[model samples]
Target chain A: MLEISGLVSGYGRISILHGIDLRVEKGELVALVGVNGAGKTTLMKTIAGLIRPTAGRIAFEGSEIAGEGAERAVAAGIALVPEGRMVFPRMTVWENLMLGGVHPRARPYREATLERIFDLFPRLAERRDQKAATMSGGEQQMLVIGRGLMAQPKLLILDEPSLGLSPLLVQETYGALRKLNADGLTILLAEQNVKLSLAVSNRGYVIENGKIVLTGASSDLARDPATRKAYLGRL
Target chain B: MSAEVLLQATVQGLQMGAIYALIALSMTLIFSVGGLLNFAHGDFMALAMYGALALYQSFALDAYAAAPLLFFGFFLLGFLMFRRLVQPVLAAGVLAGAQLTLGLVFVQENFLLMVFGGDYLSVPTVLSNKNLVIPPLTMPWPLLVGSLLAVVLAAILYVVLMRTDFGRQVRAITQNSDAAALMGIRIDRVQAIAFGIGIGLLGLTGAIIVAQFTLTPAMGLDFTLIALIVMVIGGLGSFAGSMIAGAIIGVSESLGSLLYGGTVGAMIPYAILVLVLLFRPHGLMGEH
Candidate 1:
């Protein structure tokens, strides 16, 4: 469970995410969709504690985590699969997953969690010894997600899960997300693919210009006139 | 010259090569882990030399006996220097860190000068005057000991870097700091430890140097230049390159001395560096 209110963050001296608010309930997959540069990735990074928020109240299970660094956020059961699928390029797929579960609390259960990740991404198990950098884009994406799962995160935030993938891979990725959520994992899914994200998510939010423009049930938001006009490209 | 004289020269060159490799390895490790050129590397070796000397004077411990303590103390100093000074300037680029370290070198050398004066100090070794003569080579026991220690230290470092969890994190950060940080590694902490290890190797080099050579504050700059030459010829961040370069430079300098005049022999390594750079600009083993 995560709650964020009035979060603002950006690079040095330039604000990317203006005042924004969003939430994800326990064991729910919440979709945050928008166009490019819509502050979706910025919001995920802010929640993951990779960027220092200028003003925010980010609470994960009643503890404030807005300004805590990335390592601490991970230790407190938050794992972020960043945009661009930034897996450790030179490391083996297995080593990347092992590194993902390096926090003190996660270390004990690492072996079991690794087995789970391998099961979820069967292709990764076959190529565990190979370098992540050498893998194809779709396989690399799966490994990135599997690496995130190795952390045993209470909240796994997926950023642009379908970017740069083929339609088949996108369907496979979203199907994997559906199965993950069905297994009672909380996810904050950020996507540019509006139809696919809303189809799988129970609740959804539209972000634009670093601010949340609308928030509602996925079914309602998908059919809403303004949401349809701006995101779905329907007249 | 007799066959024995030539053998002695060969043994001496090998001994010196081993020490040079150790010092060059320190530079290589720092560059790879911190992405900085560490111009103050030889100065840190000089600092360890002085630190060892001070400890020896007060406690009368032999150089070998004083190594563990010296390495630990230098590691702490290195960690503090990286955290307090190097890391801040690191963001500006490698040049900034190098300049800061270069300035630190002058400050350190001057501080040693103020305390110990400009006179050369030698550690009185049990093997100082002893030699073991084979059929062709008259080998000094101290050179043997120093070279053996260098090999042992290199082996230990290889093991630590290749077979540990910390090593994985270190290697990851060396390749890409941002990706490692996202995977829950504390980059600052790992980098601090790396800086400590780099200086700790230098401390070992200083201890070995005390066994064979005299020490003085002004010697740091000369040694720093030699280490830089080795790093550049071998490749900026390649350990294997540094070791091979060190040995090549060492043997060539000796052979040069034998064939040509003393000054020309000394210049041979620098000349070889130009040749190597012409062929491989990044370094013989460096990644572009």
Candidate 2:
């Protein structure tokens, strides 16, 4: 339900993404994996419309969404759980979730959506009144995902959701994303955790520098000689 | 201090602090939501004074009628100013936006001077020279009304911020604009409304000021300074912080006047601001 072609974007005076092509079909959990500074975050941001692309097209369900403002992008059914888990630190855990579904389209089903989110993260329900800043990193990571879900998105894009989590917490996060995918949610996750990402994704792509270097079924890519050597750390 | 004297001073302090609290709250709202420090905030208060004067001369409306007019008027002006003056400079960075707003203060001051002239003018509201006497203490109508309104308005604002969906969107924008946008909040729309409310509050404070103080084109600077100091003492973006800090400044200033002299009292809030910055750099109640 999403496509990007010839997507060129960058910070001022320096281009990071050079003609990168990517796609995600309905109900699929796609992983974009690469090492540090591989422009993974930049690509995710470009798709989410936080950063405007200098050139190329990003289409969601056939309509070009390139250059759309972040708000319009969300309205068009794209929600991004940005890197660093940007929760409203001063606001309550529940308040953070409330903000997620503050949009007009999401408002109608906010109660049901909220109940579902609470069911997914019971820990959040317990800490509903507590300030988000006080929550642990793992909890905040979950909060960001739950907040993204609050937007009632068609395509949820997360940038390095497991970046700083402990190994166990990372596993839990990946497991939750797996369940959400099985519930028929489409997801685009960017990560430097190559092995874990490949393990969870239906399809995977390896990015180097700013371009997609490889793509295939998760199992096929995980076994490929180049992918294994470069990403999986198994020569 | 004698009980009666102390009570009198406390009342006066609270009265003065209420005005500062309104201005500081206005400043904080914009800072939190748009991430913009509007230097012209007090100038907008000055504009509201002029607006009130013009409205009164035109329609002879009382405080009730004037409040809404001042609010809607300044909100519209703020909306336009954000779109035209603030937005372009915002692209350059926060400092650029600040500088542009800073420059606007002098522009407004000069405009007011050109129209109203430099003479200090006392606003004659319907409540002029009125007071409530309780033995040795008499509460001037303006101070009593201004403070009462400040408290009531603040309570209303707190309710809106904590309870309403629009308020939630606003707070979301304040807490994290980018994330709010990702949740489908139009940052531009949110920022515009926020800037409007911030400046609108400042303008309404001007309405309150006319009930209490004489006006001149240069009066904006003093209000701006007080608001800045109060916002700092209250912590940058904390509403309760502003109120408590405002009370501290106001009471200190009043008590100083009683103990030392008028000049000394005038200097007290500044001294307290420095001390607070030194000891409690985050502000009396600021979060970060």
Candidate 3:
């Protein structure tokens, strides 16, 4: 479970996120949909502890986490699959995944988590010894998501998981997210693909210029006139 | 020149090159992880040398025996330096970190001067005056033993880098610090340890070379320049490239000195560096 209120953060004197509030319950897949530069990443990063909030409160499972560094957030069981598929280019896929489980909490479950990840993405198992840089873009995306799962985090946050991915690959990725959610994983996904993101999410928030403009059940939001027109391109 | 002469020069060059390669490896580790082009790397080596000398003088400990102690000590010193100095400037950029290290060069050099008084000092081990003779080729006992030790140490480093969890985290950070952080790695802690190891390696070099070369406070710049040249020639972050480039430089210098003269020999490594820069700027094993 996670909660945030009045979150404001930015890069050195240039504020991107204004006062904002958001929440996600356990075992729910929540989607934050916004256009490019709508502070989707800024919010995700703030929650994951990559960027310290200028002003706000972030509580994860009843504990304050705001302004804590990334490592602390990770130890508290928040794993973020960052925007760009940032895999260690020179390392093998196995090495990349192993690094995911480096946290003290995750180390014990490393073997089991690794096996589950391989089951989810068998392509990775096939290329376990291959360098990450040599993989295709879709495979790299899968690798990053698998890497995030390797942490065995209580809350998994993904920023722009669909960026630069093909439509079919995006569908595959979302399908995997659907299964993971059904299996009781708590996920927070930020994406620009409104239709696809809303399709799989239990509840969704529409972010505009760093503020949450709409929040509701996925079905209702998808059918709303404003949401359909602005995001789905059909009214 | 006779074949025997050529064989002797090549063998001698390789022995010395092995030590240079070890020095270059230490430099590469720091640059790859911390993104700091430490100008004080060689000064740290000078410090290690003095440390070895002091241990020898005080306790009658052999240079070889003092190596592990020096490594552990320098590792702590480097760790503290990173925490107090390097980490603060790191956010500013690589140049800021480099400038900090440049300032460190002055501090270390002056400190050594004040203590050691700028004398070219050497330690005489039992092996220092001995030679290994076999048929047409004769090797100095110190050079043979030092090279073998250097190779063994390098192999140990390679194994650690490839097999350890810390090594995995290090490689990950080297490739992408942001992603490494997302994995819950303490970047500051890892970098600090890495910096310590980088400087700590100078302790190994100091011990190995104490008998082979003389020590002076001002000697750091020459080694700094050599390490820089080796890094460039080997490709900035390539471990294997450093070893090979070090060998090339060493062989060229040795052969040049034998064939042409001391001055011409000293210029050979620079000439090779220029050619490598012109032909393959990324280095032999470096990839973009």
Candidate 4:
């Protein structure tokens, strides 16, 4: 349950996100697909409060959270697994997960969260003391996902989870995300993996530059000829 | 070299190094988490020493006796200093923070000169002129006590950082401030507490200075420079490394004093730092 209206954000004088509007209903797996430099990351970052919006009304579960810092967003039940697995490289695997649980609300349930995460990603459990930088790409992805879950967030916004991942790893990661959605966790999936994102997500939005160009049911968009040609590389 | 002479220099060097370690640790603490070089740090040290002077004048209390009061005073001073000086410029970037601190140092030095005058004042603690004799080696009690306290402080600092949840949060901030804040840490509050502690540690050093040595209002810059050199030698973000480097510096300074003269020996840390930076610019254990 989130609503964004006419959001504008950017770095310095260079405006990367034009006025954009989007929303997500409860327990919905919504996909936002865009090509490189298409403002996908910018939009996600704006909602998550990494970058302050010059103009926006971000309502999370009916509370206005526009221009709030990232910590406030996390406290308000929104977690962003930023692009490129931005895990603390020098921190130990266990430490990274512990960081996710640093909020007071999450502190009491940290052990339980750790147990669930360990169960979900057994590889991380095996290398608890190992530094995150040493982990393989797939493992690091799992670690970040696990880290986001540690916050017990109501809405998890992931930017390009499949980037730099092998096809099998992507499928596996998608399956895990699908399972998360099925378990009633609302997710915002941002990626260039149109087929995978649209397949797993119930609804999708296609973006170009800083504008939303298309929006509809994922299934219908998948069958759409123009989207197929433009995004899926089909003639 | 005779064992007695060698032992004497080593002992004095270690003591001097320990004092540097105290100053260096505070610098590293603020630098790592707060992301400012804190040019005003030595001014804080000067205030502590001045505080002792005030206490001595008003209450006729010994420096050691006034230590607890100085510690809390400096803590409050540090906490408020961060709120006024650091918090405002924090968002503007590290350069702003650096300049703000440097400005604060100028203000403090001028204020001290106005109050205390330009004269150099010597502090004589209870341990002053006291000596511990052991066979061929007889050491002054002031240096011995200062070094002992430095080691103890270092150990305590290590434990607090390595063994507690608060320490974990500090390390988190050191590594990633944004991530740390997102984890529900009140960054401002934590930074304030850390700044307070960093300054509070200077109380001990101040006491040692007042009781064992001498000071002038203009001498704060030297401490700041010494602390920076120690941090650079130890590595910017490494606590243990700083402590070790401080001791090494103290011993080297002693060696310089023996080889050259006192004035030339004082120049050793800078000359040595230049040499070290020429090769290992990141420092002996710098993360960079």
Candidate 5:
């Protein structure tokens, strides 16, 4: 489980995330939906410790982890599959995965975790020795997700996993997310793809201008008149 | 020119080239990993040489025996420098980092000048003036031994970069620092070690070459320039490229001196560097 409250963070002096309050229960997939520049990435980064929060608390399983930095966050069992599919371009898929398991907590389970990841993304297994940069975009996306799993994380945070992906690849990615949640993994996914995200998540929050504008069960938010009008493009 | 003379020149060039390669490799490592130009790199080598000189003067230890001590001492000094100075400016930009290191050049040069004065100094080991003769070719022991040790150090460095977990982390950081952090790597720790190793290598270079060359307080700038030329010619971050480029510069300089004159030979590396930049800017082994 993870809890965040009044989390204010940004690049330098300009605050992008202002007083965000969010939470995800154990074994739940929570979607943070927002348009471009709506502070979704900022909130995720703050939780993952890539950006130090200027205000508020981030509690991962009851211990405060605010501003602990990315290394400590990963050691505390949080793995972030960052936006833009930032795989080490020069490294092979196996090398990327091996690095993903470099955390001490994950190192002991690296072999086992790698096998599970390979099972989840067989394309990665087939291209184990291939450089990540040479792989197709969809395959790179799979590699990043598989890399996150290699960390054996208690909480997996993903930022824009479906961005730049083809529709078919997007569906496949969402399906993988669904499967991951079904396997009792807790996930925090930030996305602009409202329809697919709501469909896959148990609970969802609509963020706008660095504020949470709506929160409810996935189905309820999907059908809500305002949510439908703004996000789903329907009434 | 006779064939024997040509062969001798080539051999001598290669021996010097080996040493240049080590210096260039150190520069490349720091640049690739820490993202700093490390203008103080050559000064660090000069400081290492002085450390060896001091050791030799005090305990009558040969430069060869003082090498391990210099290597580890410089490593620690480099590590501390990164933590205290380099890391802070790293996020500011390349210019900021370069300026910080450039400042270090003055500090180190001044410190050495005050302690040792401006006189040229050399360490006299047993092998200082000795030469190994074989038929028509004779190799000075200092140059021969220095080149061999340089190659051995380079091989050890290669193994460390290719085989170790730290090496993997280093490569990971070089490719993508953000992604590396997401993978749980302590970026600062890895970078500090890398900076240390980069400067620490100069320790080995300094100790080995102390007997081969005379040291002046201002000689650090020349080595820095040579390293910069070598790094550029070899490609910015390629390890193999630096070694090969170092050899190319050394051989050309050696042959240039033999055929033309000392002035022209000194200018040869610059000519080659310009040609490399004009024709293949990325370097021989660099990725586009």
Candidate 6:
């Protein structure tokens, strides 16, 4: 459902992603894995239109949307659960979700979307009125993902949803994400959670220093000698 | 001052307090949401006053009839100008945004001078300034009308900000712009609407001001300074703060005039703001 070709982006004058290509078909989950500063987050941000691309072509459902702003990206049915669980801290959990459905892209499906989010994360419904900041790290991450779901995005780009969570929490989070994928949501999972991401993602790309050094099927990339050495720590 | 004069002064203070609240509320909304202490806020109010004067002069629309159009028109101006001009500079930093708004004030005032030739014009008052004398308490018609309008508008704004979907989005953006955007709450559109709404509120305040006081382009800085003091004392981004601070400022100035003189009364707001900052820098009700 989404395709990014030769994507190049960065903060003003400091180029990060030189030229990278990635894609996700409808109802598929693709994981982009990299170590620290791998430019995975930057790639996701560029695709979501948070950062303007110096050079790239991002096509979502057959339309170019590379340099459009975040609002437009959401309107085009793409949602980015930004890095670090950037929930509106002062807002209630329900309000955050409500805001997610505010985009024109999700307007038609808001009621059903809310039901889906609540169904997937029942904890959210219980704490709907609670301020997002007051929630635990794992809950906040879920809230962020649930908010992305609220957009009824055709492609959901989750940037490091497992960061800072305990191993058990990460397991639970990934479990929920798996169910979401099974339910037919196309996802771009950007993370350093190499094992979990590779396990769930249909296809995988290994990025380092703003370039994708390797791309292959998740199983092949997982067992590749270089991938094992650098990412899986199996060497 | 006698009992009657003192009572009259109190009434006048309350009336002035209402106008101050309206102006401060507009200032608070813009400063909080736009993330800039736009000194040009008062200029927009002046622009609305000019708009009203022009309409009154050309179409002979009374102040009441002209109010709605003035509100919507200046709101549109604020919305467009913020999107096209202010938002870009705001991305640079708060200081850059302040400079951009200051420049805007200069351009707007000069435009007013160029078009209107630096003259003072008043909106037609629908009623004579006849005082209702109640022996101990006398109320002017303009003050009564202005106070009524201010109270009604504030209540309406309270609902709009606290009880509506649009308001929820605004509060979200005000708290965290990046987070809001991630949730698909369009930051640019929300800010544009906020600027427009903020200025629309200011336009109404301007109409009220022209009803009771004479307006000049240069008075913008002075009026803005007072509104800034109110916002600061009330707390940045706190609507309740601005409202309470408005009344406090009004009373302090009134009492100061009675105790000292007009100059000391005028100076008290600045003095109180300094004291408030020294104690509670965030404001009476502002978030840290």
What is the DockQ ranking, best to worst?
A: 3, 5, 2, 1, 6, 4
What is model 6's DockQ versus the real complex? Answer: 0.56
Off by over 4 Å in 4: A12-14, B90-93
Query: Which model, 1 or 3, shows the larger lDDT?
Result: 3
Clashing pairs in 2: B234-B241
Ranking by TM-score: 3, 5, 2, 1, 4, 6
What DockQ results for candidate 1?
Answer: 0.58
Best of the two (2, 5) by lDDT: 5
TM-score winner between 4 and 5, please give it.
5
**Candidate 1: docking tier:** medium
Model 5 off-target regions past 4 Å? Answer: none
What local lDDT does model 1 show for residue A64?
94
Chain A TM-score values for every predicted structure, listed in order: 0.97, 0.98, 0.98, 0.97, 0.98, 0.96
Candidate 6: tens digits of C-alpha lDDT, residues B207-280: 76567767677768877888999888988767788788888888788878987999998899999999999999
4 or 5, greater by lDDT: 5
lDDT of 1 by residue, A204-225 (tens): 9999999899999999999998
Q: Among these predicted structures, which one has the highest DockQ?
A: 3
**Of the true contacts between chains A and B, what fraction does model 6 have?**
0.62
For residues A125-189, what per-residue lDDT tens digits would candidate 2 score against the true structure? 99999999999999999999999999999999989999899999998889889989999999999
User: Candidate 5 on B269-288: residue-level lDDT in tens?
Assistant: 99999999999989888887
Q: How many clashes show up in model 1?
A: 0
Cα interface RMSD of each candidate: 1.3, 1.0, 0.6, 1.9, 0.7, 1.4
After TM-score superposition, what is the CA distance of residue B225 in candidate 1 from its true location, in Å?
Answer: 1.9
Over B155-273, each residue of candidate 3 has an lDDT whose tens digit, in order, gives: 78887788899988888899898899999999889989988998888987888778888888988887888888888999977778988998998899899999999999989889998
DockQ scores of all models, one per candidate: 0.58, 0.79, 0.90, 0.48, 0.82, 0.56
Clash-forming residue pairs, model 3: none
Compose the digit string of candidate 2's lDDT tens values, residues B136-229: 8989988888898898888787888788887888887777777877888887877788788878787777887687887788778888889999
Candidate 5, pairs of clashing residues: none
In model 6, pairs of residues that clash are none
Tell me the tens digit of each residue's lDDT in model 5 across A1-235.
7999998889999998888889999999999998999999999888888999899999999999999999889988999999999999988899899999988889899899998888888899999999999999999999999999988899999999999999999998988988999999999999999998988999999999988999999999999999988978931
